[model samples]
Target chain A: DAGVTQSPTHLIKTRGQQVTLRCSPKSGHDTVSWYQQALGQGPQFIFQYYEEEERQRGNFPDRFSGHQFPNYSSELNVNALLLGDSALYLCASSFRQGAVSSYNSPLHFGNGTRLTVT
Target chain B: QQQVKQSPQSLIVQKGGISIINCAYENTAFDYFPWYQQFPGKGPALLIAIRPDVSEKKEGRFTISFNKSAKQFSLHIMDSQPGDSATYFCAAPYFNKFYFGSGTKLNVKP
Candidate 1:
């Protein structure tokens, strides 16, 4: 069983540039969530996508958005990025079983993409 | 604001000693609490978890002690080994969302 996979292990961009990060959830999982982890900090929830729609979002600004494809893959887009946006972007996947919610499924994470905005 | 708080930003323990990390949350709606361990340049992995109804849950050397009344939970690693050294995070789930603590960096010396 292949685990969650993220592309572009490392990236570098200038301020005001846009960046797109991709993620492919683990096989047999349908829900995808994105998080940002700053240096020496815990991962912060960015948003979650289920059934091709954003189900829940964190306190992040509108600059951060995401999409869930029908295949269960996901893409996180950050427009006009700021230097502070530099951080490790992690993608987590879990199965949404029944009506109980995806929280019931333990999350499996990808290695994450390290974004450096200069 | 950080809904979940973790203590002792970092800790060091001798091999074969016990290592403990604590976390507290203010949200009462949280029912599931999980601990994650992460290594450098890698994502966090689920270590163990506990529900509010359960006082404790153990998996091998990792144990999760949950105190529902105090809204606090802790992770205890018994017979710590150098390979166990890493950053640990405590988290709770609210609705379909999850919140994480700042994390604790543990160093086990051989």
Candidate 2:
């Protein structure tokens, strides 16, 4: 089966511009999460989407938001981007057996979208 | 505060040698721990994981050792090879969220 897929493998935008990145979870997964990975650093959790609503979010500001559609695809939107927003945007998918039980499902990741803010 | 902390920012090992990476967590509520491997321009892939109930788990050349009392864990790679070179991250899940370490860059030379 195809793994998690993300579109626009790479993107470039200037400061104050809005950018939207897309992701399609693995075939059997129902939950999608987004993370930001900077050069030589581990990924930081951005937020997670389930049941078409945002279930949990990390330390990101209001400028960063996401949406999950009925088909389980997800989109991450960053408004008024800044130079520090340049990083690899990763999308991870997992099967949700239950709200808490699903934590056992190992996360499958996409190749990720490289976003560069100029 | 960073929930999970990993040490040895980078490491170099010869082929057929053993490479070990360590991590510690402050959240006692975290019960599941996982390690991920990533290469340049690629996403981090799950390598191995362990739960607090189990002190150790092994898969192929990778092994995870957990010390519940110390709140520390480690990944050991045996018979390392050049292709094993990659960045490694240790993570823990809490309240449906995951906390990742800064990552360890391992270079196995042949």
Candidate 3:
């Protein structure tokens, strides 16, 4: 089965601009999460989306936001992007079992979109 | 505070050697610990995972060892090879979100 897929493998934008990245989750997964990986660093959680609503978020600023659709696809929007926003934006999908409060599902990730802010 | 802390920012090992990466977590509530491997230009992929209740879990050459009292876990690669060279990340999931370590870059020389 096709795994999680992300759009625009690479992107370049200027500072103070906006960017939207897209993600299509794995076939059997219903939860979508976004992460940011800087060069030589591990992924940092941005937020997670389930049931079309943002369930949890990380320490990122308000400039970062996401949405999950009925089809389980997701979109990450960044406004007033800063140079620090330049990083690899990864999209991960996981199957949700049991209660929503306990989410220990392993994530399957996409290749990610490399964003560069000039 | 970093929820998950990984050790040895980078490592180099000879062929047929053993590679070990360690990680510690600050959250006692975290039960599920997972390790992910990532190649250049690719996203991290789940390699193996273990829960607090289990002291160890092994899959082929990969093994995860958990120390509940110390709040630490480690990934051990037996008989490492060049193909195993990649960035490794340890993560702890809490309330639908995962916190990842800084990552360890392992280079297995042949």
Tens digits of lDDT, candidate 3, B24-108 = 9999988589899999988899999897889999999999999999999999999999999999999998876888999999999
The CA root-mean-square deviation of candidate 2, after full C-alpha superposition on the true structure, stands at: 0.9
Q: What is the C-alpha lDDT of each candidate?
A: 0.93, 0.94, 0.92
Q: Between which residue pairs do clashes occur in model 1?
A: none
Docking class of 3: medium
Instruction: Tell me what TM-score chain B of candidate 3 gets against the true chain B.
Output: 0.98
Expressed between 0 and 1, the share of native interface contacts present in candidate 3 is 0.80
**Candidate that beats the other on lDDT, 2 or 3, i.e. the better one:** 2
Please provide, for model 1 over A45-110, each residue's C-alpha lDDT reduced to its tens digit, 9 standing for 90 to 100: 999898999988999999999999999999999999899999999999999853354446888999
Q: Model 1: per-residue lDDT, tens digit, B1-110?
A: 78999998999999999999999999998868999999998999999989888999999999999998898999999999999999999998786688999999999999
Q: Give TM-scores of chain A for all candidates.
A: 0.95, 0.96, 0.94
Ten contiguous residues minimizing lDDT sum, candidate 2 chain B? B91-100
Stretches of candidate 1 above 4 Å error? Answer: A101-103
Best by DockQ: 2
- Candidate 3 lDDT tens digits, A1-118: 9999999999999999999999999998998999999998889999989889998899999999989999999999999999999999999999875354333567999999999999
lDDT (tens digit, per residue) of candidate 2 on A4-102: 999999999999999999999999999999999999999999999989999889999999999999999999999999999999999999997556844
Query: lDDT of model 2 at residue B16?
Result: 98
